[model samples]
Target: MFADVRRRPGNYGLGGTFREASAFVNGCDAGNSWGLLIGFREWLALKLGCEANLTWAGLILKLADVDASLHPSGSNLSATEDERAVEVLFAELDEFLSARKGASDVGRILEKYLRQNS
Candidate 1:
């Protein structure tokens, strides 16, 4: 699956072919950073939704929850602050994932509180 994703030159770029995918895998190996994972998951989630795969959607719904939670606050937040916030979230995610294989459960819990209040 990842190999397929890496082949898209427009997205991954023609130059340094292996670097982006390698970085993404290394990032995942570190037990933190889900930019690629989330992006991939989001795509899968959308496809699942189209196919009526409620189970798959349920698996990744937390990403949506977290995005919504932070949306309003980020509207007024500085880029640096948002970057810091993301770093904190990633750190917390790393801890959570390291503690268990069911890291998505942790993601769901965090998502519930990370969204905009209003």
Candidate 2:
């Protein structure tokens, strides 16, 4: 779902903006009561090599040099920054999901996260 969200946002029902994509993920997570996104943050923190307590959106924004004050919920990034942010987000999600294998995916991801963040 995320692999090509940046290049084809319409297909994912997104508004072709990083903020929209971020919102979509948030909705999905909340819709599942956060269970679905449980391991995502740990996986992302591992990928980023930090335990900054950032959501995936914040982490992506940090990588894009976006100010935390202008986070997705209230972001107003320029088109170029928005696009870069989307690109970074998709790249990170792709890497995180690429390790999918089965029910243990989350456990595997968490293990990696603990190793890196500890």
Candidate 3:
């Protein structure tokens, strides 16, 4: 689903931007279980090593290297941040949709985080 959205967001009536993509993803997650949400939130928290109180969307955006404060104003992602957020969100979803069905891609996100830190 996310892969398709990532590939052709225009087909989804989206501007091919992360803000819209994230909203659509979140809406789907809220409306449907999809079996993918199971443990995914916890996995995101563990991956971030942060409190689990945050929404999975927020965690994913953080993983994408987007600026924080996702809750304060519903993620004020810039053009670059939106692009990165969508990239990483779909990356994580790709793993979830795979046979492994886990957060093995977390290392990839952490690598980006590490590079940023350095």
Candidate 4:
């Protein structure tokens, strides 16, 4: 369980399959855990390049939009803008990953995007 893993810091590693690890981590229902998992998959997609499926990218975009929309102080216009941003992010990620770039490359792109937005 996630609690067990948290209690024993050295026990958990990236050794098991992503599904199993993700399920265990999300079982705790902690804030942003699912988003973190989505981030990890995006990282992998960047590494695998064209091998990464579009479905995953779509799901990530959906989650991002949902998160932004659910923000407590977000207005309708802000939500719309966030949704548009998520759409753009998905398009760029799809293009970059389709080019077979590595995680670091994708990370740099993400960093630039985040900085510009902030």
The C-alpha TM-scores of every prediction are: 0.27, 0.77, 0.70, 0.27
Order of quality (TM-score): 2, 3, 1, 4
Candidate 2 lDDT, 55-113, residue by residue in tens = 77887887777775765552788888888888887777776667754559988888878
lDDT for every model? 0.37, 0.75, 0.68, 0.42
Q: Residue 108 of candidate 3: its Cα lDDT?
A: 51
Clashing pairs in 4: none
- TM-score of candidate 2 versus the correct structure, residues matched by position: 0.77
**Highest lDDT, which number?**
2
Question: Which numbered prediction scores highest in TM-score against the true structure?
Answer: 2
lDDT of 4 by residue, 3-110 (tens): 454345247653333233334445433565534333444443444342234444333443445343343222232545444534444344455446435556656755
**Which scores better on TM-score, 1 or 2?**
2
For all predictions, the C-alpha RMSD in Å is: 12.9, 2.5, 6.9, 13.6
The candidate, 2 or 3, that scores higher on TM-score is 2
